[model samples]
Each structure stands twice: as C-alpha cells, then as structure tokens.
Target: MFDWNDIRFFLELCRKGRLTEVAKALKVDHTTVSRRILSLEKQLDAKLFESTTRGYVLTQAGERLLPHAEAMESASATIQDHVGGENRNLTGVVRLGVPEGFGSQFLSKDMPSFQALHPEIELEFVANDRFVSLSKREADLSITLERPRSGRLISKKLTDYSLRLYASRDYLAKHPPIKTVEDLKDHNFISYIDELVPDPQMLYLSEFVASPNVTLKSSSIVFQFQATVAGAGISIMHCFVADEHPDLVCLLPEEIEVNRTFWLNTPEDIHDLARIKAVTQFLTELVDRQKKKLLGVLE
Candidate 1:
C-alpha cells in the first residue's frame, strides 16, 4: 500500500519542477523528496518522472496520477477546514498567473488590501508574458487575455480594458508633432519583437501602421513602458498605466483605441475551494471597482 502522505511530495514536485524548491516548500531535504517519489513509483511499479538537466519531467504515469492526487489533496483540505472548525478562516496558497503589466502596474497596488482581509491566504503571482498552462497546473488560477476555447476549466470575462499609443512629453517635444495617424510614420517607435509577442492582440503597431520606423523592441510590456517614459519612443501602453504618469501623453485616442478582455480561469476540479473562491471574488470586485479606469475613462 502506498502512503497517502507521499502524494504531497508528488504534487509539490509537479508544481515546482525542482527537487530543491519542493524540499524548501515542504520543509524537507531534497533527498527526502526524491526518496518519497522513488518509493511511490516503486510501490506503483510505474516510473513517475524522468530526470533531465532541466529538472524532473513528469512521465505518463505521473500525468495520469495527477488528477487523482489533486482530488485527494482537495478533499484533505476541505476536511481540515470544515472538521477542524476553521471554515470561516480560509487558508491556502493560491498561485495566480497574469500578464506582467496588469499584475505589476495595476493589481500589485491593490494586493495588500486583499491580503489584509484574508490574512491566512498566501498569494503567489506568476506574472509574465507567456501563457500559463492550466492543464499542466502551472497556477491555481490565471487571468488570460483570451478566453480558452477548450479545457477542463471554469472561466469568465473578468474585464474589458483599453490600450492606446503614448509618448512622453519629452519625446513628443523632440520629434515631429503627430496630428494624425499619417504622422506616425515619421517618428521612431518602440514595439514588441514580432516573434516574441505571445498574443496577436499585442501586435498593436500593425493595426494602424503599415511600415513603422521601429527603433526599440522588447518582449516585456513593463520595459517598453519604462523606455517610453524615458523618452525612447512612442509605444502602445495600457491606459491605466500610462495615464498615471503625467509625463506620458495619449496620442490619437479616438483613432487608435485597442480593446481587449481578461478572462479569469481556474481548473474545474478546484474551482469551488474556499481559497480559490475568495481570490476570484477579490479579483472580480477589484476589476469591477476600476471599470472606468480600465475602459480609459478619466472622470
């Protein structure tokens, strides 16, 4: 018979992808994590992971075992919360994946308030430009630019936000005046490297300009914002972020508005968990409170 406790190590390893990280998270040594995994694999007579230079990659057996193990973990948590008389005080780690700009510039400021309300819930923000896989369990929940077409997931349209072309006062002063979209061709522009953009919705430059005088390119929206702030060149930026900086000026807002939606997604299995529900509620309320700001309405 396999030990139920061994599933904890297995899940941790699957999420972290590194023995040292799993060890640190569980307060155990790396060897102990490895030993538990090996023991579990031996008992089942199935290879759970294959060691590689990148770390341990889950084998077919591991993939098959994941959902069952996660169900067990969820059940254990539910029992602990209800039976231990701690249902009122929600406690667990919720890893949220989000786009870098929204996470850092928009949500980061509001996170402390949520933390204050749910003091026991640990929040991990996996803020980056790439798509986080719900199927692979990269995060407990994610805020995606596009609603997923298919997955064993629960998703909703969180909010609709706008982006517009912006340049610093210093940059506009140093270059030609952009009275119309035609004038944009004369100016140097900062934009994403074509190959690196994770989503086509991010290719805002192409929507208006056919041949842009591209000077700077980066995969990071934060870096592009910083560069635009430093007077590098005009670049498309989220209105919520750019509008906060008095130095940044929106150019041709009526002609160049780009609207996009953020979808909140969670694995269907754990969507009803107290911790996940709390964070989802927090996010829903957060976006709702800032609806005007997100839609680029300044009032």
Candidate 2:
C-alpha cells in the first residue's frame, strides 16, 4: 500500500504545481517533495504529472486520482476536527484570492481582528486583478467580481458596492466646475488601461464620458486612487475606500454611480472544512457590518 503521508505531498503538488512551493507549504525540502512523489508514483505504478514550461500539468492518471485524493483529505480533516479535538482550535492555512482594492484597502485593515479571534488559522491573501481557479486550488476561497457559472463550487453574493467619480479638492480648486456629465469631457482623468482591464464591470470610466481626457492609465485601482488623491485627475473609485480620504471628493455622485457585486466562492468539497468556514463567516460578517459604507450610503 502507498504511504498515506505521500498523498499529502501529491495533493500539495497538484495545488501549487511546483515542488519548491509544495515544499514550502509542507515544510520539507524540495528534493524531499520530489522523492515523495517518486515513491508514490512507483507504488501506484502511474505517471501523475507532466512538467512543461508552464509548470506541472497533471497527467490523465493524476486527474483521475484527484477527486479520490481530495475525498481522503476531506475525510482526514473531518477526523481531526472531531476525533482529534482540533475543532476547538481551528488551525490551517486558507489562501483567499481577492481583488486588489478589496483585499488591500478594505479587508486588510480588519485582518488583525480576525487573527486575534482565530489565532491558529493562517490566512494568506492573493490580492490581484486576475481570476484565480478554485478547481486548480489557486486559492481555498475567493472573492470575485462575478458568480462563477460552472465549477464544483458554491457561490453567494457577498455584497453590492458602489463606485463614483472622485477628484481631489486641489484639482477641483484648479479646474472648471463640473455640474453635469458633459462637463467631465474637458477635465483630466485617471483610469485603468482600456486594453488591460480584466472584466467588463471594471470599465467604469466609459459609462459617464464617451471621450475622457485620460492623463494616466494603470492596471491597479490603488494606483489610480493615489493619482486621483494627488490631484492628478478624476477617477471612479470605490466609495468605501475614497470616502476614507477626506481630501478626495466624490463628484456628481447621483449622476455618475456605478454598482458592482462581490461573490464569495469555495469548492463544494472543502466548503465545510472548519478553516474555510471560519474565513467565509468572517467575510460575510465583515461585508454585512460595512453595508452602509460599501453601498455609499452617506451617514
């Protein structure tokens, strides 16, 4: 029989797709990870992964074995939770893929509180604009712009948030008064590069002005926000983030509002795991408590 311990290495390799990353996660040497996989393959008499320029791609046998290994992992976790008395102290690494703005500007501030509450849980954030694949185990859970239409995933609407055009007090002081959307055409704007935007929902600038005088373009919302705060130009920004900066003024809030939703998704197989559940609960509560701010309901 193959050593069950070797299955952990196999699963981690499948998720991380790199011996070095799997080794770091498993706290073993990369050579040890390779040796474990070699041993596992020999015992099973199967080729599991193929190495290519893009890293490890699973072979047909590895793909076939994936669900079974995941089942074993789930069962092992359940046993630890109930039989090993680890339920009382949830301890595991849960990597969450989130949009850069939400992860860095919003959720990052509250992470300390979560750490205080669940001291044993190791939370890692993959903050970026690109979509992460839960099927590939890119992340344990994700906060995405749209609900995934297909996958072995469970998804729910996390929250509906608002974005509005904002300008710095310094910029407004120097420029012409903007009473309507048409007036925006003459003013400088900071926006995402049109070709580089990952999703249609992120194309907020075009909704208001047909031809904006875009002075700077960046792939990062945080960068755009910083530029806007420096009196660089007007840019559509999340109210939750922009409102926090007193110097940044929301312009034409009623005439130029863009709404978007955040979806929380986790693989169905691991959705019930204590660590995953804890993180999801924390996100749900966090969004719920911040509804007013997220929705741009000024108090």
Candidate 3:
C-alpha cells in the first residue's frame, strides 16, 4: 500500500513544481521530499514526473493521479475538521490574491486589524496584475477585477470603485491646453504596455483617447500612479489611490468616468472553512464601510 504522507508530498510538489518550495511548505528537508516522491513512484510502478534542468514537470502518470490526490486531500481536510476538531479554532493558512492597487493602497493598510483578530490564522498576501489560479490552489481566495467564468468557483461582487483621468498639476501647466476630450490626444500619456496588460479592461485610455501618445508604460498601477504624480504624463488612476495624492488632478469629471467592480473568488471545495469564511466576512464588511471612498464621493 502507498503511504498517504508520500501522496501529500506528491500533491505539494505538483502544485509548487519545485522540491525546495514543497519542502519549505511542508517544513521538511528537500532530501526528504525527493525520497518520498521516489518511494511513491516505486510503489505506483510509474514515473510520475520528468526531472528536467528547468524544474520537475508532471508526466502523464502524474497528471492522471493529480485529481485523485487532490480529492483525497480535500476529504482528509474535511475529516480532520470533524474528527480532530480543527474546526473549533479558526487556524490555518489562507492565501489571498489581490490586484496591485487594492492590495497595496487599500488592503495592506487594513491587514493589521484582521491579523490582530485572528492571530492564529497565518495569511499570505499575493499582489500582482496577473490572475492567480484558484483551481491549482495558488491562492485560497482572490480579488479579481473580472468575474471568472470557468472552474468550480464561488464569486461575489466585492464593491464598485471608480477611476478617472489624472495628471500632475506641473505637467498640465507645461502641456498644451486641455479643454475637451479632443485635446487629450496630443497630451503625453502613461499607460500599461499593450502586450503586458493581462485584461483588456486595464486599457482605460482607449475609452477616451483613440490613439494615446503613451510616454511611459508600466505593468504596475502603483508605478504608473507615482509617475503621473512625478509629472511624467497623464494617466487613468483609481480614485481611492489617486485622491489621497495632492499633486494629481482629476480631469473632466463630467466627461471621463469609469466604474469597475472587484469580485471576491474562492474555490467551492474549501469555501466553507472557518478561516476562509472569516476573511471573506472581514473583506465584505471592510469594503462596505469604505463604500463612499471607493465610489470617489468623499474627500
């Protein structure tokens, strides 16, 4: 019979794709991870992964076993919750994936309060522009700009936020006159690199300016916001982030306005976990409390 512990290691290795990372996650030595994988392969009588210089790539055999292993893991977690009484205390790691702007400008500030309340629940915050996969367990929960269409996932509309065209006061002073949307075509603009923008919605300039004279391109919204503040160029920025900056001026509030909703997503398998539910509740309450600021109505 194959050991369940070895299967656990196999699942982690498959998810992470690295021996050292799996070892770190499991709090075991890298050598132990290698040994367990090899032992599992011997028992199963099949090579589960292809060892390459790049990293461990799952073989056909590994792909076939992945779903089974994951299902077993889920069942084990449920069993532990009931049998071992892990449900009594909301203790476990919960990884949250959020966009760059919300994670840094907004959520990061409020994390201290959440941590204080649930000190036993370890939290990992992943802030990036790219989508992190919930099916692969990349993150326990994610805040996405667009709702995911596929996967056994549960998503809720977290909140609606507003974005508007902004330019540094110094930049507007030096540039050509900007009385209407037509004048914006000639202005130096800052936006995400066309190729690097993961979602088409990120290209907010396209809504107003047909052909923008992009002076600078960056993947980070924070970087673009800072550049706009430094008088680099006019850029579309979230109101929640840009409103706090005194140097940035919102342009043509009547003509230029964009509204987007953030969706909170969690996989259905572990959605009911006490820790996951707690974080989700916390996020909902937090966003509701700050609704006015997110809608760009407050100072």
Candidate 4:
C-alpha cells in the first residue's frame, strides 16, 4: 500500500508546481520534500513524476492518483486542525463583529467579564450594520440578525428578540395614542433609511406608514432609540435594550411588536481550533443566560 503522507507531499508539489515553493510554504527543507516524493513512487511501485526543467511533471500513474490523493489530504487536514487545537490555551487576537446597537447594549457590558476570564486573549470589535465577509477573514466571529447566505461560514441561531414601539412618556402624551399600526401614519416615524432591507417587522409596518416617511434616518438602532427618547418621533427597538432606559415607554404595549433574530457565526472550517472552540462555547453560554431578556420583552 502507498504511504498517504508521501502522497500528500506529492500532491502539494503538484499543486504548487514547484518543489521549492512547496517547501517554503510548508516550512520544510527542499530536499525533504523531494525525498518524500521519491519515497512515494518507490512504495507504490510506480513512476509517479518526472523531473523537468520547469519543475516536476506528473507521470501517467501520478495523474491517475492525483484526485484521490488531494481528497485524502483535505480530509486529514480538516481532522487535524480540529483535534490539534484541543487542550491548547486560547491566546491571540480574536476579531469579532457586532451590530452597533448590540455592541453598545449587550456586548459592551460583558466585555470586561469575558476579558477577565480569558486574560491572555485580546478582543477586536468592529461594530456596524453591514455584514462582514467571513471568507475574507473580516472577522473571526460575527453576531448578526441575518442568517448568513454564505456557504463558507456556519451560523448558529442564538435567540429571537421582539422590537416594540417606544417614545418618551411626554411625547406619547402630547401625540395621539397609537393603538394600531395605521395610527403611526398620522404621527412621524424614525427608522433606518434603507427601505429595501427585508425586515419582517419593517414589512408589516408598511401598512402604517409610507416607506419614505422615515424623517429621522440612521443606520444605528441605538441612535434610532436615542431619537425616540428625545421626542424625535416613534421608533421600534429591541425590548431588552428599550427596557434598560427608564425614560422611554412603549408607545402601544400590545400592538407594536416585531420579532427579530440573533445569530452567532464562525468560519465553516474552524470547528477544530482550540481558541475558536473556547470562544464559541463562552459566547453560547453568555447568550443563553439572557434568554429571558432576549426572548421575553414586554411592557
């Protein structure tokens, strides 16, 4: 039987199309790579490669076995990446992406605790409404409301949150009471400017107001809530976040409701790393603890 490790070295050489390049990328001596290829041919009783002026050319036997060898290499590498990171202490920078609203309300409060637990690990947060591409390493992990469409990343649904209309108590009293979605049309509304985003709640709000009537527009949900509190107008916000401020009151306690989801995403192939595993587990636990606040937002 052919040695699979030897087959891997052969496959790498084929992929790189040069012995020196493979050696450099793999951080091995060039001779070591050459020796592995030679050893592979002898074990298989096959002339697998020809040394050419350009580099190594695959023989007929090598060409036949190339696909199988590459597949094996991929499978083995995936297994190793996961098992290899086990029992390793997590250290280094972990890039995390979050929505500005969540970053300010939830994550910011727990960062000191998360850092305290893993003091060796450094956190880098990028807060925005735009989704970052995990395929490009824009972030190691992301907290998002949308279940990512990219097949290159894995998403775990953490929780669903409800957004309820809120306004300053004074504003609610001065303006006509909003008992139904249609009542919002008579009153000014504040929301994110983009009328194109496919928000389930936003779609339902169309019955109440024209899409363009978003007089006060901002991408940040925190800013939207701040506008509402300052009597700028009525806006929908996550109940957990809204409840945090005593000044804002739910505009229509029973009628104003839109459910939103939260997701945790990581690179699809990162299931094996020790640091990634620890961070993922910690985040899962952290969100689970707030299940009540996240899921049950009333009043």
lDDT of each: 0.91, 0.91, 0.90, 0.74
- Candidate 2, residue 56: lDDT: 86
| Residue pairs of candidate 1 with colliding backbone atoms | none
Model 3 agreement with the true structure over 1-299: per-residue lDDT tens digits:
99888988998888888999999999999999999999999999999999888789899999999888988888877666557764466778899999999999999889889988888888898997677998788999999999999998999999999999999999999999788999998899999989989789989988988988998999999899889999999999999988888898889888999999999999888788777899999999999999988988865
* After superposition, candidate 3 runs with Cα above 4 Å error: 82-89
| Clash pairs (backbone) in predicted model 4 | 82-272
1-299, model 2: which lDDT tens digit per residue? 99999999999999888999999988999999999999999999999999987778899999998989988987887777657864368887999999999999999999999999899999989996778988877888999999999998999999999999899999999999999988987899998888899887798888889988888999999899899999999999999999989999999988999999999999987888888899999999999999999998999
- What's model 3's lDDT at 181? 95
Q: Where does candidate 3 clash, by residue pair?
A: none
Best by TM-score: 2
- Candidate 2 deviates by what RMSD? 1.8
Give the TM-score of each candidate: 0.91, 0.93, 0.92, 0.66
Candidate 4 RMSD computed on C-alpha atoms after optimal superposition onto the true structure: 8.7
lDDT of 2 at 77: 74
